[model samples]
Target: MKRREFIGLVGGAAVWPLAAQGQQAATRVIGVLALESLPRTRASLAPAQRRLAEMGYVEGQNLAFEYRAADNQEDRLAALVGDLVQRRVSVIVAPAGPPIVAAKAATTSIPIIFFTGFDPVSSGFVASLNRPGGNATGISVLHTEVLAKRLELLRELVPRAKSVAYLRSSTNLVSDHDRIGKLQPAATALGVELLFVEASRPDDFEGAFAKIVSAKADAMLVSADAFMFSNQTALVDLAARHKIPAVYPSREFAARGGLASYGTNYPEAYRQLGDYLGRVLNGEKPENLPVQQVTTLQLVINMKTAKALGVAASPFLLARADEVIE
Candidate 1:
C-alpha cells in the first residue's frame, strides 16, 4: 500500500473508530474565499480537497469547508472575508492576489493560506518568501515575474507581428503597473510595440477588443489575473472574432480554444495550498511555513486554433510545448 494509505490503515486500527466519531461531531472548518463564482472556485479546488484527503482530512468526518465566492465582483471580497472572519473558521484559504489581500485585511489571527499569481512579497502578501513572518503563507504562481517569458512565447507564435496587445483586468493591481512595466523592456528588446487593453468587468471585454483593434495590434497576451481567467471563454471568443493571435497564462485557456498558453500549473498550486493548510491544522504555524514559488512552467499550443487563425505553428515550437491540443 502507499505510505498514506498504509498510515491511514494503521491509524484506523488504534483510536479511529471512537476518536473519529468525536472528530466527525466537531469538524475542523476551512473557509474558501475566492473571487470566481462558487462553481468555478469549487472546480478549481478539487485538487486541494484531494490533497487534504491524502493527508487524512476526510470531509464530513474530520474536515468541513465554508465556501464564499465573489463571482467576479471583486468588491464583494471584503464582505465575504468578513463573513469568514466572523464565523471564526479554523483556517481561511484565499486564491489569487485580490482574495489574499482581502483575507489579510480581515484578520491577522485567523491563519490565511493563499495561491497567488504574482510575487507574494512585491504584492505585500508576505514579509518574505523564506519566512512569511506572519499568518499568511502559501504558493505564488510567479506570473508577473514571467511576463517577459510569456511575451517571448507570444512573439515566437506571431514572429512577423510588429505590435502586441496585453489584455488585463483594469483593476488588477499586480498587472496594472508592475507586470506592465516589466513587459515594456521585453517588448522593446523584441522590437515590438506593446499596447495595454484593460477590461475590469465582463461588460468591458468587447470594448477592450475594440481598443486592441484600434491600436492595430497584431497579437495579444492575456494577463494572469483571476478575473481574466474566469472570463477566458469570452476573451478567447473575442480574440477569434477579431482574428488576433493570442497567448494566455495557462493551459485551460488554450484548451478553451485560445491560440496558446504558457505558465505554471495552478491546480498543483492549489494542492500545495491544501497541503500547507493541512500542516497548519496539525499544529504548524503559518509564520514558519515559507512561501513557495511554483517552478513547473508549461507551454500549451492549440494547433486547431492556430489553423483557424491562419497562424502556422512551427514544428520546433510544437516539439517544445508540454501539450498541444488538436
Candidate 2:
C-alpha cells in the first residue's frame, strides 16, 4: 500500500516495541503482493483479514500486514515481489493472476499463498492439487472450467439473442485461443454466435467496444481475468453506453452495474485463503498442504440495471441467484 517509506518500516510495526521489551518474536508479518492499488483490493482483503483475526492473529498485537501493490501494472510486479521477499515476511499472499507468477519466480523457499481462477497445475503453480509438491498452495477456482456454464447463463439472460460478444484480454494469445476453442462448442449448442473482441491495455478499450458495436452483438460476456476485473467500471459503462446486455465473470462487475455475473465466489475464496494463511503461519509447510479447490459458484443479478436496460431476467434464473441487487 504505502510502499516507499513503509517498505523500509518492516520487520513489523510491533517489531521495535517488542524488541525494546525483549519480546521481538511476538509478531508475525503477512506480506501481500497486490496487482492493483491497495484501495481496490480492500474488498478481497477484508474477508481474509477478518478471518485471520477470528483465528486470533490480531494486527498491532500479534500480526502485521505488510504489502506491495503494483497499481495494476504487470511490469511492476517483479519488483514488488522482490520487496516482499526482502522484507522476510512469514507468508506471501499473491492476489491472483500475474502477481502469483512473479511471486513464484521470485521465491522458491518462502511459503506463497494465492487464490487464482487459472488452473494451478497447468499454470505450473503446483505439482498437483492433492499434494502440492512446492512452497505454494491456496484456493483454485479454475474459472476456465466453468466457461461453458457462463455462456449458458448469458443465453438465459438474453433469450432470443442470436449474437453475443465475448470480450477477453489479448495479452496471452495462445491461452486465449485455447480458451476460445473450448467456448465454441457451447456457442454452437446454444445456437448463438460469439463475436470475439480483445483489449490488453487501457488505451485499447475504446477500440474493442467499437468492434463490439460494429459486430452488432446482442449481449456481451466479460471474460474472467484480472485485467477485465480491474477495469470493470469502464467496461460496465461501455456496455451501458452501447445498451448491450452483458454478463460478467465476477459479481463485482454486476455490483458495479453490469447486467449480471455468474462465477466463482470471490470473497469465499479469500476466506479460504485466510484459513490457509493461518495454517502456514502455525508451522505448516506448503508442500504438505493440499491446495483448496473452491467448488461454489454464484450468480448475481442487478435488478435496477436489468430494468434500466429494459431487459428482464428469467424468473427461474432470479430464483436461483445467490444475490439479486436492487
CA lDDT of each prediction against the hidden true structure: 0.89, 0.85
TM-scores of the models, in the order given: 0.91, 0.89
Which residue pairs show collisions in model 1? none
- Model 1 misplaced regions, further than 4 Å: 1-25, 172-176
Q: Write the per-residue lDDT of candidate 2 for residues 32-72, one digit (tens) a residue.
A: 99887787776678889888998889888899988788777
Best by TM-score: 1
Candidate 2: segments with Cα more than 4 A from true spot: 1-23, 171-178
Tell me the tens digit of each residue's lDDT in model 1 across 1-326. 89999998988887768886786567899999999989888988899899999999878778999999998888899999999999999999998778998999999999999998777887788899999988999988778778899899988888898999988876645434777788899999999998877788899998989999988899998999888879888999999999999999988999999999999887888798789989999989999999988888989999999999889988999999999998
Which candidate leads the pack in lDDT?
1
Q: Model 2: how far is 17 from its true place, Å? A: 6.8
Pairs in clash, predicted candidate 2: none
